[model samples]
Target: MSTSAPEDFAQALAQRLGGQSVRQLAAVSGWGRTTVSDIRAGRHIPSEAQLRDLLMSVGADESEIASWQERRSAIITPPAA
Candidate 1:
């Protein structure tokens, strides 16, 4: 398997959540079809607000959501101890 990573959480989530063929994001706050689609396609990046909402939509708790938000830019590098 290739070690190369995918673009971002949005892409990964979309894949895990299934169906890139659709353009609807019903329960995710402030996120309609276009925003989700753009993020998944890597055509655009999501804002902090959008990121948090995405996590909540996917059944993630506040802690997980915070972790995802706090480390979005840090995903490219490991954090120091």
Candidate 2:
């Protein structure tokens, strides 16, 4: 499996947001503006619920959402020693 950094996934999501402001996306996603901003800035990795909300709000397809979720899992999962 090809692995992508969480920052790259975050950047893709930000680009998918198009012209929408972070504040606007937060409103649409029912999350705090700071949370959305942090995600966009790659300072925070979104929880599954947050990811779902973001994908839905931005009308992301199932494939895109799945790809992001997989990337997220890879980032958070501990590596074998």
Q: Candidate 2 at residue 39, lDDT?
A: 87
lDDT for each residue of candidate 2 in 5-24, tens digit (9 for 90 to 100)? 77677787778777789988
Model 1 ranges with Cα > 4 A deviation:
1-10, 16-27, 75-81
Please, what are the lDDT tens digits per residue for candidate 1 over residues 19-70? 4243445444557777776766766656777777766666778877777766
Which model scores highest in TM-score? 2
- The weakest ten consecutive residues by lDDT in model 2 span 1-10
The TM-score between candidate 2 and the true structure equals 0.81
Prediction-by-prediction clash tally? 0, 0
